[model samples]
Target: MAETSRQIPERIPVNLIVNGNRRTLDLAPWTTLLDALRDHLDLTGTKKGCDHGQCGACTVLVDGRRVNSCLTLAVMKDGAEVTTIEGLGRDGALHPLQQAFIDHDAFQCGYCTPGQICSAAGLLAEGHAKSTDDIRELMSGNLCRCGGYPNIVAAIQQAMAQS
Candidate 1:
């Protein structure tokens, strides 16, 4: 081992309100929102599937909008409200989408469940999905490798109905 020493850049300050908690973090400007959430904040509910923004597994709500966290830099979301899967519920109760996923058996491996639910919540919030087909189209970004599309749609529909 040649005692390799690599220079690390200085971390910049970024502020965000995550899961209803204000967080101040010092991180490299190149750090992605997904990395900031999972690596720095220990909020691992956001997954990194493609790291290229092709997969919605890293989806999160930034200022009430659905975003691919992996493609977004931490500094880009500074002073923004970020919501991960862990923030969807309150009072020890599951969010409607979470419960719907359980009731509809929307997940198998469950790896993409968090992103799916978050995306669904954003979909509902956007209020653009008027039909199942619309939901399918809007949620096409979040891919479920287990082929649980039907159940996932049903879960979203259930959550939408409840809303």
Candidate 2:
């Protein structure tokens, strides 16, 4: 008789409420929230730039606050509400900040758009100052290699003024 090999442990079950939808995924405990969102959940709006938290491209909102998805473990976020860039708009309508970004040409390469928008959305919600210095300070974390800071800041300021 041939001996059977033992099965590996199953992935841990986690519940993540993303973009107003509840998702159940079986993922490895070591999986980061970024990977779970991009790989398993297929929410690619959250870009993985540095993956070490040095770059803010993986930024998302955890319970309406900004966070680096790559820095957070998938298991740690179980039952938590996560908001990706995909969640920022409604049916066929862009969020005010999103439209502002487009209007201001905030991005050049566009890779950082998702993170930039996500971070800006949170910053505006925080009710910070509308000065260029404050906007630059708050948005410093989300870097654009194309040197699009001026446009990015303009977009945020425009949205803030309108709001």
Candidate 3:
């Protein structure tokens, strides 16, 4: 029995603060945060693209900042607060940014929508620069290959103006 138990790999325990909730999980050390969120906890709002951190598609907010989940190790984020696109809404109401995206037509194909939205949320929280140029510069990390940049900018600016 001891030998049989030793044959099974052990999962590393981690505490994740996700969307304002604390969760403890036993996961493989090699798992990425992306997989932990989507596969384990069922937060599917963060998209996986390129899987190499080049597409900026797996963006999520960690401790009120944006990061590429595909590049982040699950075990390394122990007790770190993580927020996905799902966290932006409240009680079935759409976040203003979400509404703005809809109003401005900020997405097509929609595969990149989650990353774009989450990145914009983090951008607004930073409050570093106000000009469109600055927004463009800060948002450079997130890419929308579907040519949704203009509308995405419009939606972000609109939400900023409202907030």
Candidate 4:
């Protein structure tokens, strides 16, 4: 008889600056950032749509850049700053983009709203989008099943103009 040995996964420490707060978590190396945010930190606004990188529902900002949380491991983001839907607003006030979303009616069912908003923020910060076509092209990664592309583009454009 032959005996086989199985290796056990170990929990590793990860330090993240989430929503302006430093959060230290012990997570398995395989734990995704989406799981860490939704499961461990209780930040559920960042939705899990496809669970794959194909859908941008789990999009979040890591160090001011947009990222697919489901595609990246939490351990890989150690010491990085992470921002979710919950972090966009401040002092009980909505961010300009959030307000623009509401004013433009950019969401319908709202499942993909968070990711769309986050991606828009990143796009705005990148300062490359100059027209509606540019906004649409840049925001193509974040899909809205509700077919809210028109309003989404308008909202982003309004927000960009205001900023």
TM-score of each: 0.94, 0.92, 0.91, 0.94
Summarize candidate 2's per-residue lDDT along 30-119 as a digit string, tens digits. 899999999998899999999888779999999899999999999999999999999999997999989999999988889999999999
Which ten contiguous residues of candidate 1 have the minimum total lDDT? 1-10
Clashing pairs in 2: none
| TM-score comparison, 1 vs 2, better candidate | 1
* Comparison by lDDT, 2 against 3, better one: 2
Deviation (Å) of 41 in candidate 3: 0.9
lDDT of 4 at 99: 99
lDDT of 3 by residue, 14-112 (tens): 899998889998998888999999999999888889999988889999998999999999899998999999898898999898999999999999888
Q: Write the per-residue lDDT of candidate 1 for residues 46-113, one digit (tens) a residue.
A: 99999988879999999999999999999998999999999999989999999999999999999999
Task: Please list the residue runs of candidate 2 whose C-alpha ends up more than 4 Å from where it truly belongs after superposition.
Answer: 1-10
Candidate 3 residue pairs in backbone clash: none
Instruction: Give the TM-score comparing model 3 with the true structure, all chains together.
Output: 0.91
lDDT of 1 at 45: 90
Cα lDDT, all candidates: 0.95, 0.92, 0.90, 0.95
